[model samples]
Every structure is written in C-alpha cells, then in structure tokens.
Target: MNAIVIGAGVVGLAVARALAMAGHDTFILDGEPAFGTWTSARNSEVIHAGIYYPQGSLKARLCVVGKEMLYAYCATRDVPHSNCKKLIFAADASQSPKLDGILASALGAGVTDLVRLSANEVRKIEPALRCEEALLSPSTGIIDSHAFMMALLADAEAHGAQLVCNTKVTRVVRKNGQWAIYVDGSAEVAATADIVINSGGLAAQNIAANTEGLDPATVPPLYLARGVYFSYSSVLPFHHLIYPIPEQGGLGTHLTLDLAGRSRFGPDVEWISEIDYRVDPSRHAKFVAGARQIWADIDPTKLRPAFAGIRPKLSGPGEPAADFAVLGPADHGSPGLVCLFGIESPGLTASLAIADLVLHKVATD
Candidate 1:
C-alpha cells in the first residue's frame, strides 16, 4: 500500500516508520522547514508512568505500553534518556486522599510500581520537599525528544519512506478510488495515496474540516491551552521530578530537571483562543508561588521566563478531559482514512504504541 502521513511530528514519524517497515511506500509531509518543531520540540520531555489519566482511557493504556517500548528503543538506539523517577505529592492533609485515587488509577492502567510515602519518608530521600504525602513512580523519567524523533525518521528513511518539508497539506479530496491531497491551496494535486493518516498535531482539526468527502460532524472542536515554563538558574535541590496534584487542564506547575541536571518549573495552563508562543514575564510571581508550595527555599531571583507551548485540546474549560481520538475508516465511513486528535502530554512516550495501533487499524480495515 502507498501511504501519505500529514504532519511530521513524533507520532507521524513513528507511523511512517511502521508503514515503511510493513513494506508500504510511505511519504511524510510537514508545513515547517524541519520536522518535530511544533509540539514535539516544546514540551516538558517527561516520560509519564501512566498515572493520573482515567483507567480504560487510551492515554492510560498506551502510556503504560509506550513507556516501556520507548525505554527499550532508547537503549537499543543509544538515545539519551533516564529512569530518574518522579514524585507526585500533596502539599497538605486535605489533598492526601488524591494520592490514593492516583494510585488506584495507576494500578488500573497496569502501573504497579508506585509507592506511597509519608512526609517524613519523603523527607528522608528529598529533604528539600515539603509535602504531606506523595507517590513515588520509579518507572517515570525524561527523554531527549528531538533525538528520539531523529531516530524514528532515520528508521523510516532507511525503510524507503520519503519526507517532504515546507509543504502544507491544504485539502484532501476523495478521487475515483484514492485520496487526492492538495498543498498550499493550489488547484493542482500535490500527491495521491491509497491510505492517508491525518496526524497534523495542531492543525488536525483544520485539515479535517477541509477534507471534502468526510462528514463535517465527525470533526471535533479544537481548544487551545498554552503552558509556560520558568527555568531555575541555581542548582536543583531535588533529584526526582516533583509534581503537585493534577489540575483541570493539566498537571500543576511542577518541577522537572533536564538531562543536564538543570532545573525548571513549569506548564502553568492558560486557555487561549489563538496560537501564541510568547512567554509572559509577569507570570514569574505565579511560578514563584507554585514553586514555594514544593520547596520553600526556592529563590525568586533565579526564576526566569523560559518558553511556552500550546496544547491542541479537544475539550474546553470546565469540561471533562477527552481521550485520544483515533478515528478510523470504520467510524467516519471514509475508506483508508485515519485521523488522530488530542494527542498531547504523553504523545511522545506513546509514539510507538500509537504507530502500532494505526498499523493494526490499517491492516484490519
């Protein structure tokens, strides 16, 4: 089968590798001059342990499976990553029961390595932390996402997949028996393929709306949520990733360290109406307050505006979070068309698993 995958993000690259490895001629297209420049580059880069997501959800199932696959892939490919572990904590007694709920959710998702810790117990390992209770996730860690994407692209190219950058897929129309893709709104068809997968991270909804033969009702509304990070200039006190209780749209402003051992506090979520990457320096006070909840000794002077990334969310404010939406040909009545939406957070970790799932769908359909 000849396949065309739109958007060369991590998930798209992984899917291309799978299609190519399965003896299909694969082509990857992206709007940017380089791949993995959007959501793939702007992230916390943490390898989640499948916690917090509701049990039986795609995020939970794939995250647990993808975490292990990613670790193994990193090892074999010599990609830089670490099992530095993580600590999800409750700042006071009122929030302690959330720890048990998180544990139950993790267990349901097949993550059984979480260990409950008391404040004193946590102090023994991380004296700088000031939490009432916490759950230690030994399997959680961080990864060099850029390197990981590079590896996937290398494997795809090695397996005869071609990648074309700076070509934005404007519309997809159903021809006689195949899909005709147009780029940059040009009247001429850019290419045609037997199978087409829409993995356009941020631009997915727009692409689906522009798809001629697809049902407009199947296109879910796109919600944008921007998250900003602040880098800590001084040395980090804690060894493991420190997280607070989950919030409505995201995990709270927690602390995470890069592979170089440098510290950063981040991802304060703010709902937005448009795409913007500008970091607000005024948010430094909010970051300081959030950081003080975990480590009281955090110096405000060291905190500086680092960067920001917007999430391509499906649900809006005050609504329950949505699961990963992988709409196949069977659901939308469009032959040989598969679309993925709301692939944020653990998408990097779940890249390989998502690819496998897409391949299985392609085979069965």
Candidate 2:
C-alpha cells in the first residue's frame, strides 16, 4: 500500500516511519523548508510525565506511554537529552490544594514516580525556589527537539520513507477508493495514495475542510493561541524545570533551561485571530511577575523578548480544554483516512505513541 502523510512535523515523521515499517510506501509532504518549523520546534521541549491531564484522556495515556518510549529511543539513538526532572510547585499556601489535585490526577493517569514535597523538601532540591509545596516528577525531562526530529527522519528514511519539503498540499479527494492529493509549491503535482493522514499541526482543520467529500461539520473549529517566551540573560539557579500552577488556556509562565543551562520563562497564552510568531516586547512585565512568584530573586531587567509559538486549540479562552482528536473511519466513514486535530503541548512527547495509534487505526479500518 502507498501512504502519504501531510505535514512533516514530529508526529508526521513518526507516522511515516510506522507506515514504512508496516511495508507501505510512505511519503511525508510539508510546506516548510524543513521538519518541525512550527509547534514541534517552538516549545518548552519538556517530556511531560503524563501529569495534569484528565484521567483516561488521550493526552494522559499517550504522554505516559510516549515518555517511556522517548527516553529509551533517545538513549538508543544517541539523541541529546537530559533526564532532568521537573518541579511543579505551589507558589503560595493557597495553591497547595491545587498541588494535591495535580498529584491525584497524575496518579490516576498511571504516573507513579510523582513525589509530594514540603516547603523544606522543595528548598532542599531547588534551593533557589520559593514554594509552599511542590510535586517532583522524576520522569519529566527535556530533549534536544531538533536532534530528536532528525533521528526520526533518518530512521524513517532508512526504512524506505521519503520526505518532500517546500510542498503544500492544496487539497485531497477520494477517487475510486484512493486519495488524490494535489500539491503546489516548487512545482504543481498530483499524487495518489491508498491512505492519507492529515497531521498538519496548525493547518489541520484547513486540510480536513478542503477534502472534497468530507463533512464540514466533522471539522472542529481552529483557535490560534500565541504563546511568547522571554529569555533570561543571567545564569539559572535551578537545575530542574520549574512550573507554577497552570492558568487558563496555558501553563503559567515558568522557567525552563536548555541543554546549555541557560534559563528562559514564558509562553503566556494570547488568543489571536490569525497566525503570528512576533513576540510583543510589552509582555515582559507579566512574565517577570509570574517568574518571581516561583523564585523571588528574578530580575525583571534581565528578561528580554524571545521567540513565540502558536498552539492549535479546539477550545477558546475561558472554556474547557479539549482532548486530542484522532478521527478515523468510525467518525467520518472514510476508509484509510485519519485526521489529527488540536494536538498541542504534549504532541511532541506523544509523537511516537500517536504514530502507533494511527497505524493501529489504519490497520484495523
């Protein structure tokens, strides 16, 4: 069977690898010049330990399962990663209750390495942090995202999968039991495949809606939420990722360190009408305030505007968060077609697991 995966992000590359491993001729098409130019590259790069998501949700299940797979894969592939744990703490006594709730939720989701710590215990691990209570996630870590993506792409190519860049898939249509994919960019081309998987991160909804025979009602609305990061010029005092209590539409502005031990804070959620990656210099005040809640010594003057990334959200501001939508034949009555919607935060962590799920759905359907 021949398969085409639209969007060459981390998830798309993983799916292509899975398809090639299944003895299918797989091709990955992306509009970007390279893989992971969007949401996949622009993130905190934290490998979540399946915490904070509701029990039995896709995010929870995939994250727990994927984190394990990722650590093993990184070790085996020589990918640059750190098993540096994370500290999700309550900045004040009033937030202590929320820490307990997060613990319960993480336990319910099968993350067993979480340890609740007192103020003194938190200070012992991260002496610079000031929190009333905290949850130490031993499994949470960070990875060099570009290296991981390159490894995935290399492995997929080794298995006979091919990646095509600078090509935008204009539309897809079902023609006589196969998918006709029309693409434009470097050259106008039309290709046919036995299966088509829409893994387009930000433009997933647009891809689904453009399909000739698909139902418009099945395509959920897309909300673009821009989150900006601010880099700290000074050295970081803590070795672990620090997260405050999650806020509406996003995790609160927190500190994350790259492999070089440089610290940065941010990703404050801002809802927007269209795609924009520009970081507003004015948002530094809010980031500074949020960071100080975790560590009091943070200097506001040292914080500077950095890059930003947009999340594809199904729900809007002040609304409930939505789960990963892996629509298959059961939802749209279309054979050999799968559409992924609203895959945001843990999408990078869940890439391998999601690829497994997509392969299972394709095989079963």
Candidate 1 lowest-lDDT run of ten: 245-254
Worst 10 residues of 2 by lDDT: 182-191
Off by over 4 Å in 1: none
Q: In order, what lDDT does every prediction score?
A: 0.93, 0.90
Best by TM-score: 1
lDDT tens digits, residues 1-365, model 2? Answer: 99999998889988998899899999999999988899998888888888988889999999999999999999999999999999998888899999888888889999989999999998888999987889899998899999999999999899899999998998898888899898873233378998999999999998998888888888999989998999999997899999998876668888898898888898788899999999989887888898888778888889999889899999888889999999988888888899999999799899999999999999988
RMSD of each: 1.0, 1.5
Q: Could you give candidate 1's per-residue lDDT for residues 190-303 as a string of tens digits? A: 999999999998999999998888998888889998989999999878999999998766788899999999899989889999999999999989999999988888899999
Where does model 2 exceed 4 Å of error?
Answer: 185-189
State, as a TM-score between 0 and 1, how close model 2 is to the true structure.
Answer: 0.97
